[model samples]
Target: MTLVQRELVEFQDVLTPRAISQFLGTEAWALHSRRSFMETWVHDSGVGRSLEYVHIPTDRDAPDFSRRLQETASTLSRVYAISMGELAERVSAIRADLFFVRIARDSADGTIPLRQASGLIDSIEKMMKAAAIVTANPLAKGTGRTSERVRNFLDDDLRMGHTKRGSFIITIAARLHDDDIGHGADDPGAPEREGPAAANRVTRREGRADEPTIDFSRRVMTTLSRSLAVTRRHLDHSDDFVEFEEARESGMTAPIVEAIEEIATDSGGARVDMRFSWTSALPHEGLSEEPVIFTPTAIERAPRVIERFARSAGVPANTDVVGPVIGLSRDTRAAGEEEGDVIIQADVRGSVKKVGVTLSGNDYNWAIYAHRHRLPFTVSGILGKKSGRWWLLDDVEVDASFLIARQHDRIERLGGDAPEDPAAPVDV
Candidate 1:
């Protein structure tokens, strides 16, 4: 079956709160009265501020609390199971959206963890692992739902804005699938079809099949690498010089230029070219916000730069600049020099810097900074440098001393020698 089909089946097995309570050997009445396990405990704000009291009611007719707890646990478990199933589907989907049957069979045979699936994605896997580590210790059965604990668990490990309980359950499911597939028994086929003799044969086959096949995680990594390579090539050859002479410019060119320069500096002084245009108009009333115009020229080239940087840094590609009719900009500045643009600034954690883009009339500018390097950058330009005098700046210079010092410090920290840059021809 296809991954989607498998997902549909798994989704149907989602358990209800009553079922969860029964599984946990708890009364349904107590579970429902406390808002589904989240309101059972409170955090003290004073010194030694930890969870003070855990309210796991015993023999009480806390129908509301019982129902709540059952609901919460059931919701959490069901969500997690569905998420794991989806992640498995995603991995198979990466092979072919309809390859879930093979993928599931392979997974059951110990080929790969469900977390390695494309549906789970890297971000989801990371979140699942983190959640697994935090929630491994099962809370006391009657401790009610500890929302704060759950929230903290999600916050410390998961990406922001993805902390819903359902989301958390999905993450947990992926982790469970990973663990189960890693150490669980292989499917023994239909019992009636196999019988005792067939079972013996299956066991013998499993022992012989102990050797691992193509590592699913590695395959995923390889697939991502190849996809990124193709994306990089497209970005490199994209038509980045097109212009929109007829549209009303929202004045974002300057900010876009600044973003390019910033990207170059962050990229260790690489070379880059930037182009920006409005994709739509800003709303004058409650009708809708003006949609800044995005030219085709900018859209094609943006993803190449983004994918290149993401691959080099071992990060996920940003999706904002990957689509058409979006105000797009491309950057290929020299490594370290890319940091001079607002769009490519690095944080203390070495994450990409983000900045807000503002449009005014036929021009625009960006306000962004690199937290780690403490470097600030900006972009500004007009709609048409020739007719409307709109020209985009694709490159910028960085403080050479700062770059050298930073490079040296990084090398020293890593106990390694500074690497030399290879000489290459400039295309522009």
Candidate 2:
């Protein structure tokens, strides 16, 4: 096979643009709350600035701080059973709003006008309280860990001497999948986000004409994409930290957390970790980095092709099967299926059967996805009962990235009512 192209691509996510948006939307309030936590304590002065007095000898906030930290930890245990490392890696990075920090800092120096400072303290406190409540919500447990981390980020850094004086921004870059063969404009392989920078409102440091408009989508894509298919071991929270027992009882998989330690490791490129410092600039130098490129050698052809078999013959009322498939034969007749309807064949264990499907109109995408990927398809209903293929489905789901793409495409055919799936950022 002749290799065509190969390169590293980095983005916050690999899911379809729409799913990524939804996932990011879920994390948005969490990010805002986490940032608010940092601002409350650190005041954005960077190194050596977090609740500076809290770590001192006469610190009155210590007890409450510790209690709150513990409270946050308990909330986390209730909802998220992920590991500390996973917690750190999966949390989104939200940059501090320097404006609020600056105003507060200036007030201390008597430079801020009384008008600006009057309700400012009240407003800040309100925001902090709101943030605390948001973080404590078990329904969005990821924020609990993020809240703790952001609240203590500066202090931890100061203790470790990793604190830098300037404001920190989150940066993103894609490391292309090592095995990614190639990408085309229309395919999912391309992670290039087609839009302005994720955050369009960039403030250029007076002399820095080279400032880059950061892409919020890029940051989001990277954050959520990295979280996919990854699962941490279940932790047993002691009685002191137990609150959401019902959450634990229901299990953590409903929110789509899975054990992807192996599959995630093999499938995607390295995840650009955003845990410690959320610098807005990635490693490629300048504001943003280019998408890593890759070469495609030769596409492997599947051994079999399952064509869609027409259900012309009498069919049993109950029959279903799932397994690898081949393309349909050309001779089959079509009922309600569209023009590209291919025959499908699945052999569960040892039973092999063939069948065709009349779909629920073209309202769903993946109209030709099976044909494109040739993956296993489940055949159920009354069509293939005579072939002795019954109840063979294992109910394993396809990846969300693929599932959404198929869904998004179908909804598009229904005219103007379909919501467009956002363009997804691929790698980094």
lDDT tens per residue, model 2, 1-428: 11111100111122222222212222311112112122111112245743211111112234554344333323332335753222222332222111111111212333434433332333222223223323344354232233553344222311111111222212222222111112211233334332223222343456877974333323333333322212111222323222233433332221122111111121221121113233232222322222211111100100000001112112334555454434433323545543333345553222233444433223112324545555455545543221221222332222235434654565566543444433221110
Residue 271 in candidate 1 has what lDDT?
Answer: 36
Models 1 onward score TM values of: 0.19, 0.19
Q: Rate the local accuracy (lDDT) of all candidates.
A: 0.27, 0.28
Model 2: worst 10 consecutive residues (lDDT sum): 298-307
Each model's Cα RMSD: 24.3, 26.1
Q: Which regions of candidate 2 are displaced past 4 Å? A: 1-214, 218-256, 259-279, 282-377, 381-428
RMSD of 2: 26.1
